[model samples]
Target: MGFTVRQIARRADGGEIIRTRAFDGAELSVGRGSDCDIQLADLGLMLRHARLRLAGDGRVAVEAMGGVPLEIAGAFVTRADLDPGDNPTIMLAAHRLTLARGEDGGVLVTAERVLAAGDGSDAASEAQVFTLKKTLPSKRRLAWGLVVLILGLGLALPLWVMAGRQTVLPPALVTAAARNAAPVATPASGWQPDRVWSSGPLSTAHAGLANSCGACHAKPFEATTDTACIACHTPAAIPAHAPAARLARGQVPATGLVADVHKAFNLPEGRCASCHKEHEGPDGALQVAENFCTDCHRGLAARLPDTRLANVPDWGGHPAFKPTLVVQPSLTAPRFERVALAGARETSGLVYPHQLHLSTRNSVANMVRAQGLPGKNGLLACNYCHVPDSDGERFQPISMEKNCAACHDLAFARDGGVVRTLPHGKPEQAAGIIRDFYLGQALSPRAGVAAADRRLPGSEARLRTLAFTSPAQARAQADAAIAGIFGKGGTCAECHAITDTGGANLLTRFAISPVTLADHYLPKGRFPHKRHLSYDGRTGDAACISCHSGVPRSNLASDVLLPPLSQCATCHGGPQLATAAPATCATCHGYHYGESGHGGDALRVRLVVARRGE
Candidate 1:
């Protein structure tokens, strides 16, 4: 009814290890694979070597798998039947399997290893296996040969090339050489052995110095000198990031192996070439590591107690921005102070309620919609009055005539078909324009008047009530109108701070307080509005509100609407922060605060030398 397999393995110590397992089935598998009911460790045998099944007449059926024949009694057969009355044996490579009738009236197979393990007599010849060791040179000899080859190619050849010629000569030496030089053949310009020392191709900015290494190297094994850099880069072009004395005091001490190496070579902390590394390919020019700035700025206050700058290890550690605000308003020169954004207020000498202007449901928005004024979605938007400058880094100076004039016109009267607008900025000019207009109107005769109703010329009063007003009457009317215009609730008083000085004339009486608005709030940092015009697929008004959330809610023009540090942190963070945009010190600030440096170009230097006839 079932099949039983017994495996007998002989141990090296003359002990027999027998393992017996029974399968309650009509069939059993035999193979070299472990999953087979009867497994063998012979490489010659197929994974599924054979299958044993019990026939209907109680005979054991042996069938070979994968065309592998089974040997039985000196005869090989793919399939064979053995009766219980006659026991039979089958060969499977190194092992032999015997078939017999079990006590349960089922097939029983006993297997044993006939051949011993590790018998390598059938292995390939030793000469074929050890061919590499016999043919090739020894490891030690080959290593020595490589060492000598490297020394010649890397060190000896480069030294020879460097000793033969100086790639670049001084300007003065070049001038002298040109005058005394005779016609001589020069070496073909191509790759030199010394170029092997370069880590990578030269940056685009330093591409001209690729062949002429002496321009920067000057000495064979010494670091580049600042004197060579200063010869061309004028102080105006690359001014110190800060005063040198203060910078030295504030600079953090260098650490680690790299710093130790620099110190060993007598290299100082603040070297020009330290940050502006070369030979890193075209795109690597002017690239500074994030740690270069963070190391010093992280704990700068601890090093220099008198420093005004706060220690900022990352964006999250950055203090609130201190904007330059016009603290004291003056007619000539306004006094400014750097105040933190928390309570910063600017006295621009103007009255404007942002809430009133920016409100969607207010009169300003209604008026804009009714009069077809500029706005986004028929509502007053920030761009209506505020306009970005050419570079979009900051806004253009707000002009009353250009920005406010569309909604708030200055027209007081009309002359024929021409609308006469009061002159802006100058109170004296505005008063004169108004006075002259009234005077001209009073002096002129009525357009539709009857001559018959008029008295004779001698009897006619020069101050005519119905026809023409007198000069004094015209002057009074002009003065009254001028007072109303410059006074509270008037057109001029709406935006400006008006002061009435007691004077005999209308022109000298009214004075408008001067306005001084900051062009840039944080002068030390740069914020490009162009890049921030859109955020998270939101453009136009929505993008603007994302940062300037306080703009619409602000009632006073003096209120600083500049977003706090938290606003920028929503999207931007330190270089290591993965959740936000990476922002390093160089992203907003520059090392060279003055105008950008020049004169590095080799072509320009050649042109200058040509001009000087040297």
Candidate 2:
């Protein structure tokens, strides 16, 4: 059984207003404290005044606690018995509690304030004693007075001050001449009352707009419009997330009471100010909450049925990275395909075995140490060939001269005191240099082609025979040398794809296939190497090897050494997970742009594939 409590209050019109509540427990507690089952606001009442419970004789036992006396029927008693169908009134301080039987075989308690209650005959005297007419001013007059005061100071004063305010120029557009010029004294230049209406200090990016309220708040009593933002930020600088129609269809419909209020006010979505809030502080960062992205992207596929993007609720739901790779090798125009890392292969018209070069106990390692190349303990390091770009985010393109020329010597011939080397890139030039050297050697006296010294009287005919055969011999020698240079196991053929395009001369006979290596594998996602310079306190090659575990064992140039999705799960998880680093959508991917070179991949790979055509 439960205890039913009813609190009755008297209105000015002599009507009663009752509030009822039920508490389910074996006993009913009454006190002035908030923790009591039936609390009284009177200070005279003790914290634990009394308790009522069922007795063995089918009656309710009222027991006073903390040595408090209970006044029942004008008699002070420590304890009393209340029977069913019997109404007993208990008086404590200024409260009157009427006890009776409940409808559900429980105790019913009705409490009322009896401080002002008197005999029915002297109603006029009782009313005069409680009236506030002789004590203070009326409540209505005071309330109206406060309302007028607030409107005059908060609204009227600010409007009056803002009317004659001078305009402040944007900080970026301010010229040097304007700074050196003397300040123009005006009445509006002094302290103004409108400054009091400022919410807070502006952020560092919009600090110049602090004194320029009209810059953002174009209309009075209205929020900052997107037009004000577009004035400073051009459409080209900050492009829309997608086209209007598709973005609208993809947007998740807002719900809840707050959303209803916004809809009632006809609030529009996709506003700049909605995400990037201002007037927070001078140096506060504008961190968009993770929910803003997850709300729409969590179930985007259901809303945007035609979209090619997968629904990404959080980092745990992220798909495998698809890197743009050159599927077909070509010199003029290479074919590119976005394939998952598991099936990715790059035909860059070059052959390089990372395992062979990276080994510490092999011939490549011995050659590196013998030549004093960039390696540690005769082992080739990643930095020896792959150097970081200016930003240190990505590696620079590999070069034959800077990286390979030292080990792979191109010297084909040696003069008197000079070593002649073939040109690195120009295959035709290298062939011509070899041909010229052979032709010069054929006609030289050292070759004995036309030598007449220390010869017999009839040796002239033999000298003529030697000169005639020398040209034919020179041609054969040039052809053989050119074939060896451009053939398999040759210096030029070892790294590059040599194509034999026959021509009239030896110089134009061979062609080297063009090589294409993507600077960025994942154009849509950003991975900054500088930010992750160390892994568990391990730096340099150790840190890189932690993520790129397959590089050392990889033997084929076509093998993609990019880390898979599971590797990233080691340190990062969903934004809500406390066990790992929080990874929101914005952490690795930009809303409107990608990595540091915002112009390159950012403009190229727009996030959603549906908007790519438009």
Candidate 3:
């Protein structure tokens, strides 16, 4: 009997719908005669890697695994390799095979299992088959129901716990409350406690010592304990006991103290313990020795001879104490006595008479007696002309405009009836005039008036314009003008004075050695001595005592007193001391004159004059 299997419908939509047929009575026609035959053949090829096809109307041809070929005929619907009595089985295709309906509807064809060439058809073979079926349990539904129950319990667990509590506060609030309650105050018990030591106690060895710990130790306790004790104890104390005790009692003057120390041991400005040590410790005492004082005071002391005499006591009028010897080194030969001025002196040098001027007791009386100028009104005080220390040192070589302007008010007349206050010295204006003159000469030398006429514009046009006529003429004229201003006797003593006895002039001395370079316009050195001697005249003149009334001669010459310029101008008019000659600028500044090489001809440039009219 042959069996046939067919797939009436696939299991895609819902359930399986397969059709099977069995042909047992007739010689089982095994061919692809019906859809069931075709289906069986296709199923066999798919599962066994077999190819099946209808050879003709009834016969079926098949090629099996490993290229074995065979033909089979079947109309049975059973597992291809299974008997009908075996448990119903299902076969799935292993490879794709073509199937076609045969002309007759009774046959089914499939690839048959073939035997080796040597094997007979009667060889024993066993065929096995199995059926497949799927069954699902209802446990999935129960699992879903259990999951819902667990979730519900999870949601209600916290609420139930809260409901049981008497006071249900938020977790954060509970935590805060617990923290606050943990440190509640608890009162101390009745018994008192022993003192707790935070720092180590001082060593017992040092406790009984009379000195404080600080006396031996410069730093606090933590500092290194190893330190020298003798450093502080060995040296003498400041302000030795004898002098200090005397000073405390007010028995001796402070100057007396300075003198006594110098006289006894040549201590010079000494007062005990100046260089001794009293407090001993790690950090040494801050004291200097007597030698240091000699460094600075020595110079000053040498200049003023009386400084050394301070130490000498009144030895029953021992002929006005004099210095025993100079304590400091000297830079130049010493002039202990004043030099005399006699005979015709050097014309180019300054002349002064110190004795005549300084010796006069009453300068006004001396002046009245010497000059015999009845209107002179007794000799004037030193401050009347030569200012003293109280004012700035005005005796120095200073610019006429700067020193004079302090007392005299300067006015410059402009084009209209306008007068402007001019700056003292007018350095900027002077520089500008010089620069313009040089520039004009370089640009056009022969364009203006005569070379001698060096003025600028308007009525002074003749002076401003340069009619050099020739370069030689211009050069000669410029040279003459410059020489006239800087010449030895030119304008040197107009503001300064030399004594009739031919003493050194203050201005000349100051010019030689200036004191300070800060004020460029002012001469560096001072001239009070020269001015005093000259104004006083040889017979009698202003006395040094007039201005330096309270100051002793023992003081340094550099320490001379000074007065205001207003005081000097009271006698000497400011105009007489300051004005230049009407026709020439060289009368004031003569050093700045020259001709430029670039110009066609030489040009003589001069300072501009500010006259009332032009």
Candidate 4:
């Protein structure tokens, strides 16, 4: 539990002086400084040189505090466990210490000088103390031996073997397939001794080039440059990520732990290897972590105060999407503007009411059911008009000739067993067509009225009733027919915007504005109609219309009846949102500008002409 120390000193006359001091603590400290319990005057001792502590088994454990080891039983050691009664001797600098059991079952330490101070400077004893002839082999000898061994085996021997090689081995002969051609029993083709120096095997992506390392390592001891990889990963011809790396780095937070680490490593900003790291065993999926995006995007306003983008921590923390809508009436220069879908409207120059066509009891639905478009109770489904493309990722561009012409027939005349239809999308030429039809009929009228009797209810039956014997009379009648059709309640003017040319008679010079419908409403978001056709199955019928709540009530083509953000968030939200479908920014947003890379409702298009084109 305690220790007592006796310091012994010798005078010049060979007389000794001893002073005993008691220390009542669990441990004892020895050193040359006055701060230690057993202080020595010798300059060779350090301040707080060693410590002696009582072990649980009642043995005294001595340990050096400084780097120097204490000499115990002629052996230099930093630590040792010994019994006090055995009187183990320790040499700390010039002092000789002995440990013994005291009368009170405590530790007793006695210290004395082993040699006289004057004798340490003697030339004969100094040579014996300083010489290290047989202590161990010289470090220079071992280092030179290792150098010789490495040069002889690791380099020189290999070079010598290479010099003796009669013929240079082509890369094709060094391949793993070639190396394994001979039997394993002998040093045959499998003996590619140079492979022993490789650090590791090639990754699976580059495994084929293992025998041809020169493809990338063109110069030894130099790293492979990006030019070696760019030969394979060429980006699309379209504009790619920023050409200036500073602009890319500007998005990263200027001060962060990761940024500090990257700075310490002298890593430049915005390299492809940051996210596209390879050689990670080659088989695992190589998806970038969400933090890669959130690092620069989360709290971006604080780091880059001037940016217009909202800080999006994740998918659930996104701002409301402003959907792109055609905002101009002119087809030649239609301006697209992004507006929040909640209360926005489009400017398409057509007048279609979805509710009227999709209603269960409407005439449009009756006609649609007659054509058998997967309807019930005489209602038309969304698929009747909005047909999906071949991949079902998006709807094909709506075709007036296919979807609308079935019911909105533009028949103006009839021959035997054939009803003639007007050409669509050429409203300016409609007047000429009407004039020619009547003139041809005036020259050669059909033999019977039976052909005209079979025409639909809205056909130009009244025009056929007019009695015309001359081309001038037929021309006058055709003018009346064109005006009646281009004006209100006429077939051509019902869906299209018709206008009478300035300073011209409405009967002869009326022009209908071409109707333009966009293939995509939102260019920044993507919607796979196939995936969402059953999003809300609450109702047995009209499952697709539940989220698109406005479609059933929307009557105007310019209404832009996209569902509101609140409606979509009900099912799709941030990853942390408590729902069946959890999403993140990657769920609907993209960090890059590739059209194919963008997800969500970013309209993926397959341009199809009659023979299809982009």
Candidate 5:
């Protein structure tokens, strides 16, 4: 029932010099008055400041003697319960008193003057007359001031402005808000007034919605709803690396305590902002790390058993590439199929014996060198025909006129300083020109006839008639010429696969080569050739043949020459792999549809909106 209160004090040197007093007290009087059981001489205290005693129910009670109250537990109160065993301390005026259990069930009281009394003549002291312990305003005073400032400015001022807005708001908006019983914002004064509650600056991308805090945090201090985001970001949903159902559908459920708590809260298993958090720092939006994507994709096969997606983790753990190729030989009817490039074959019609043309000692290379051609070192280079586009991302499709016409000539007939060239592509037209030439020969006067051959002027009409041949006979001669040119060893047959349309009754009809070449092999993955031109680890740049090793020996057009993933892994591999590239999940695979999505990120369009000044 009885206890002691010991007061601890520090001297000028910061040493703990302690002094104690044991007062015989089931009841004690503590004041500046003479008759008080505990006397204290502090100018700030009244004659009879407070009375302390043990209550009938075995608890200590302290009460003010008159109207003046004592500071109890940092609060001013007229009465308070004190358990000395708890080592309770109370303050009166400039003096601090502590109560504690003393020897033999008696209570001990300790007192010390903690602060200097305020000088009455000072201008600051005149403002607060009764304050002695604190010459300045106390913590309570400052705390109350802050509370008033927040409520009056952050909340109350905005409410007052909103009320003012309601009067002038257009009838349309006012009626809409009233009809729905919702507090919708109307155009207000320049001062946003409510921005005092804004946590921090919005990301540079989202800075357009800065003034409109309620655009996201609609409710006061409440979590943002999906509706807030969906309002503007409807079609462009946040990229959720993997589908939501994979992780959200747990079988036996999470067993750990933290997991249980999370489950109980029904926290979103796949929320957009979970990974893309905002208002963190001065830096705008930060990109999510590789762990965000790998976490869901690592063991995804087990989670979603029926998923059609190829089970792949990060770039290092990717599966073999699947390249799309046209299965049908003709462009008239398209058919596509994705097959692994390692053993994939192409059925592009023309046959290209790569070794014959590329060989240094071969006849074709020798002919190219004899002409002092566009190639280097008396040999054909890949770039001689495979020219890159303006951007150098990929090669332009090869053209016969631009790339091949220099070595091949179209001339077929020459007579008397007049040379006739057969049109390169038109077989029938070239034959007709040949037939007309022979008809002109039959009509011309013979050079050896001399005087007799000049029987001419009067007989010109007769001679011209002899030059014209029967349509059937002329067609037959033209067909023969066309056949010879389209045949196996003809000029046109050297490079192309010749096919006759089987016109037995009619003449000859030759069909040219049917070939289709794609500049890009893998449409889904972006491989910037410019970036890879210098991908050799130690040396500055690697040759194209380093990756396409089969190109030098690839004789047939059917050989699919794309390198396998193992070739790329020599430099680009796992972080722990010896290679320095350390490829991650984002190197090749894009999560979205456009160039903006090439790096698995959305294009953050920074709107240059005019900001409201502070």
Candidate 6:
């Protein structure tokens, strides 16, 4: 009998082929010619565009047709197969070959498995047929589909339901949700929600509340009965549980009472909702009336302090009340003049020639003509030195180095020349001389000495008496004597005095007074008084008069001109004016008047010493 290969089991290189029944329940001989390979004729059909179904058991079965040894096992099936050169014939399984037969009787299929013949047989075999079943989809794909459906329902259907429910919710419930959703704290992030007014159409006004409505009102659409609104929104009651809420009300205990009065008169009962809306239109977060505070406070001004309500005058008919001051703290009145001038007076008894230094016009004009220099550049007005007062009378301290030294060329001597150059004698000796002169002058009226008793006991005689004492004792005595003479409250009138006529005098009429040698003798490099007197009109006499003008109305100082430099260039300049002038220093040494033409021997020393010390 010619049998097909049912199921071929074989090993290569001379092993026996085991046979099994084909899918058609037939058996056949196993042989090499019985094996066949299958493939799809139309490859595009494998892709699933539409659902596919199987005939039975969700499978399609194929059978071996021709008399050839064939076999089928698991997913494998075989049909007739030809020898290597015999027209290449093949017996394909029907199910594995899914092509419509042409007029020439050909078949096509996508072979899932191949079968081989174990024995050479020309008969059909059960192992030569195979069946193919369509596969079921995996669980993961089904699960993903279900999830997509659920998400679609959640997004679309719930939104539709919420839209309908929003209209039906009682205003109280909606308001409760809004109030609960509001942030409890004053957002550190400073985010504020727009306000909504209930007066207008809800649709028109609700646009402003698109993202949030709880930003402004405590509760959105709730029953805002006067009691409920006043409890939280008004300033009168203390916000019990919420500190942020209290701050939002902006009504501190001191000012809250004032706000209450405003609400009582200006805003009516049911109308609270009008101005204090929950969610206003865009740009309505801070929309309270600016005059809300002042409207009520103006009537009660009599009861409040001027400080509490800045005393703004009512200008004719203009409304004087402003409410912005109540809300913004930075707009308060400025504090009036708090700077005092008590620490700016002179510490020394030297009378600053405020008036004499102020007369610059004549000196400046004459100097300008003589020097052929511009008059404008010669002298500055007095206001330059004595600064004006904007708010009140106040004197600023004069800088000795800057203002005084410009003309006086004097440096301040703290311990009466202790640390500076000595003039005509050692500083200690000069200090002693000054101390004795002060004491002798002090005792003169009592000692029955003549007013001309200006000289101290001869230096040689005084030294003979003091020579027997220790140096320490001498220093101590010198310090004591100097202190008594220049000590605080040491009878300034006895030496220095501001006369009614304002002309100072030493013996008869000194520039500074007291006839004491310490104030009398100074360094010699300071002002050259002779040069200043001869300062004709280099920059015009206006420059000379700039600082030498007399005081106005009185002989005291005035604010008219600055100090002049005519005295400085006089002695400091090169060459002498005439041959009669003496060269020896003694000609200008004595304290008496002479034909030497010197301003004064001691006065020159005082001026020069003051300058060098500076």
Candidate 4's residue-wise lDDT over 159-212, tens digit each? 555445443323433342233332121112333333444466554444544444
Give a tens-digit lDDT track for model 6, residues 1-614.
11112233335684656443212222221112323221122212221111111123222233333432233333333332222112222233322222222222222122221344323221233233331222545578778988887765644544444344322223433453344332222212222222122343222223323333332233433434444444333432212221333323322232476658645554332234533354344424224432332232333244433213232122112222111001111112211111112221212334444433333455433443444432243443433443323422222344444333323221112222232211321223544564454344344322322211111111111111122134445445545433333333322222233232322311222122212112221111122333333234443344345334433322332122223223323332212323223122222222122221112322212111111101
- What TM-score does candidate 4 get on C-alpha atoms? 0.58
Most accurate candidate by TM-score: 1
Evaluated at residue 360, the lDDT of candidate 4 is 77
Model 4: worst 10 consecutive residues (lDDT sum): 605-614
Candidate 1 ranges with C-alpha deviation above 4 Å:
1-149, 156-192, 201-212, 255-260, 279-285, 330-332, 361-363, 370-373, 445-468, 595-614
Candidate 1 steric clashes: 0
The order of the candidates by TM-score, greatest first, is 1, 2, 4, 5, 3, 6
Q: How close is candidate 1 to the true structure, as a TM-score?
A: 0.65
* Candidate 5: segments with Cα more than 4 A from true spot: 1-136, 143-288, 361-375, 390-392, 408-481, 489-495, 505-508, 537-542, 574-579, 594-614
Query: After best superposition, candidate 4 residue 190: deviation in angstroms?
Result: 14
lDDT-wise, the better of 1 and 5 is: 1
Taken over the whole model, the C-alpha lDDT of each candidate is: 0.71, 0.71, 0.30, 0.64, 0.59, 0.30
Off by over 4 Å in 6: 1-354, 361-378, 382-396, 411-614
TM-score each candidate: 0.65, 0.65, 0.22, 0.58, 0.53, 0.19
Worst 10 residues of 6 by lDDT: 322-331
Off by over 4 Å in 3: 1-311, 315-381, 384-401, 404-467, 493-614
Kindly list the per-residue Cα lDDT of model 3 for residues 18-80, writing each as its tens digit.
565544333232223243233333323332333333334444434343343332232323313
Residue 304 lDDT in candidate 1: 84
